[model samples]
Target: MNLLKTSVFNCLFVCSLIFFLFFLLLFPKESFNAALNGLVLWFRMIIPALLPFAIISGIFIRFHIADYFSFLFKPIIGTIFDLSNEGSFCVLAGFLFGYPMGAKIANDLVVDRQLSKNEGEYLFLFCNQASPVFILNCVAINCFKNENLFLPIFIILLSTSITIGIVLRKFFYKSLKWDSKEKVLKSLNDNTSPFEILDSCVMNGVDTILKLGAYIILFSIIVKMVEIILKDFYYLKTLIIGFLEMTNGISYISSLNTSFQIHFLFVLFCVSFGGISCIFQTASMVKNSHFSMIKYLIVKIMTAFISILYGILYLKFIY
Candidate 1:
């Protein structure tokens, strides 16, 4: 396995280097311009989230607040989803934070031997959705320009449906099981210094953010290239463009003179798939930890489908 990883990494490094050189040779003007734009976008969207998130995560984990919250949700989780306390706690955190942060928290708890790896794996599907903060503030209010709280509400509902399907499949249907005999819970020592947690959080955040930025730039170039090649193909371009670039996809769908149902379904898919850019960027960030891209994608696709179903039902009831 180690040998395979090494070989793969070497191949990727070489391929990327070759691509860079070839791009520079063939399209120096575009390459430099694209690189500059990438840097700017990285600074704008990626960098700002790094330090603050790190520090906040550190404080939460270090203070044992996460554990406390986990305990509080234990009963609700057990009753509702038949999940463990740790799982519920991580789910709650994911609801508050977004993407890799949620995944990161679960990863940390697993490493600390607080939850069984299998349970962590199960919770991961539910725990890896857009936070309420992002959906409400960033997407619903800011992006959609509509005050209808239903947007975020439906997003949460759709996310929940996706998580449920993933859990059911992994645990019972798909027969994909996590290692059950890994570890047990830990008593958080009060003496664990605050600085240590802070340092870990900041370092992890920076590393994750930079990794995300690398993927963002790469995927952005791919998106740009694909858009140029298929400039005339409207439907294919719209679909691919939406998948590769999230906000742009939403904008495209919104501009179409289509039915409300189509628009709603597109929005749901954009939120669920989170675009190729989002997936690539997020996968890059959380790759260091025990995150499963396959499982995540499965859950995302399921969520998109469920969101559409819910929208159909909603429209039927309204009409």
Candidate 2:
């Protein structure tokens, strides 16, 4: 059965690639423009916003900064999420820096034997999220043109993430044991020189960012191709693009002459789900680890749904 499934998957993947190539050939101009747009976005927005966070995270890990913060974070994270001290760093990175950072940190912890596979998997679900900066600055103020929406959107996203974490901890991670304290402590005590650590961190950060950029470009092209194919159905096109790549999806939605409520809901959903592009990027980050991308995808979908529900409730009650 497993072999048959694998064969079927391979066939489907080959067919999809062939279809994509044919589409590219059919619409060369569209493909070129889309690829160019992706490049612009990578160099303009993603690089500036993401690179510093990646480098800082690398430095933090290399220098065992998490160990210092772990003492303060352990009590709260442990009580709420049933996670160890190291898990607090993943939470902090995810909340502060956003998408794939949390996953990257969890992967690093797992690789260093600071966190067990089960704990890492649990962290992967809720720790990886849209950054507050992206939500407030990019989406709320810039895209929506309403500073008032910033607090609401930020609160909703943060609350939903914490709620998901709590629920998952209570149900899924109850059976998983924490890593050995001695091993974690040993890994935290690195004797490498500061210059050497800095060099390694910079190199690793560059490699990770490059990989992220490639995924963004690939998905941007795919999303554009999909939009070209579904030209007539504007709503469907908006959703399809959003599902494939978030920034483009939000851009399309914002351009439309739609109701504020509709626009708000759509943006909320897209940001929460983070689109397929983000999923692929995160999967690449955790490929070497035992974290399950499939499970993470499910969590994203659930979070999106919850966000939609919260928006609706807020509208009915407050707005």
Candidate 3:
């Protein structure tokens, strides 16, 4: 079964890449515009938001700064999540920095042995989430055209990631736990000077961000091709767009003549799922680590569905 599934996935992936190449050749204008949009977004929104956090998170991990979390904050957040100081730091990075950053930080922690292998894999699953700025500003105001919609969207997205993480932790990863006292920070990176470490982090962060930009551009082009090919099946086109890359999907969703409920649910699903582009970016980040991309993808699909369920309840009761 596993071999069959892997073969199927490989076949689809190869076909998709070939089709994308066809898109590049056939519709150069559309593809150029799509690439431009993705590049502009990466330069304007993603870089400013992520680069600083990326460098900071890397420095924090390298310096074992999480070990010095304040007495007030540490006891509450650390104990609550059953995380060591480092894991608690990752939660903050996840919430604040968003998506693959949390995953990157979690992978770093496991490499540094700040978290056990089970804990690290478990941490990235849920800690990886959409940015608050993207949720509140991009999706809520820009796409939905209503700032008031932020609360419901925020609640649903946050709740879904947390709930999914908690359920998986309870069932499959029974052995993962953090004992702060037991953790001893040891690092092979200790030989580096502060300057070297800072330089390395900045370089790595920029490289990661560039890869993210590439995925975004690649998927943006693919989504544009979807637009032309599936114009008759509007709903299907939208789903395919949302599945490929998130930002373009949200922009496309906004321009549609759908009902408010449709807008809300599609945005909810796109943000919740993090899109295929997001999944690929995340997988690249942890490719060297023990983290499971398959598990992450499965959980993301689950999150998308759960977000819609939450959206339904919210729309029925609260909206």
Across 118-213, the per-residue lDDT of candidate 1 in tens digits comes to 566656655566655556654566555665854545555645554574556446544333356645445556565657666777787777777767
Best by TM-score: 2
Q: Global lDDT of each model?
A: 0.64, 0.84, 0.83
Runs of candidate 1 exceeding 4 Å displacement: 1-42, 46-51, 141-143, 149-159, 162-193, 285-291
| Candidate 2: 10-residue stretch with minimal lDDT | 180-189
> Each model's RMSD to truth, in Å?
4.6, 2.0, 2.5
Error of 2 at 238 (Å): 0.7
Q: Tell me the spans in candidate 2 whose CA falls farther than 4 Å from its real position.
A: 175-192
Better of 1 and 2 by lDDT: 2
- Candidate 3 residue pairs in backbone clash: none
Give lDDT: candidate 3, residue 283. 89
Runs in model 3 deviating more than 4 A are 1-12, 70-72, 178-184, 187-190
Please report the TM-score between candidate 3 and the true structure.
Answer: 0.91
Q: Candidate 3 residues 1-319, lDDT tens each?
A: 9999999999999998888788899899999998898889889988998988888887787777766752346676565556667777777678667777989989988877778878889888888998888888899889988888887788788888777867876788777775667667686466778898778888988988898889877777777788999999987888788888888789889988979899889889899888888998898888767688889988888989999999999989988
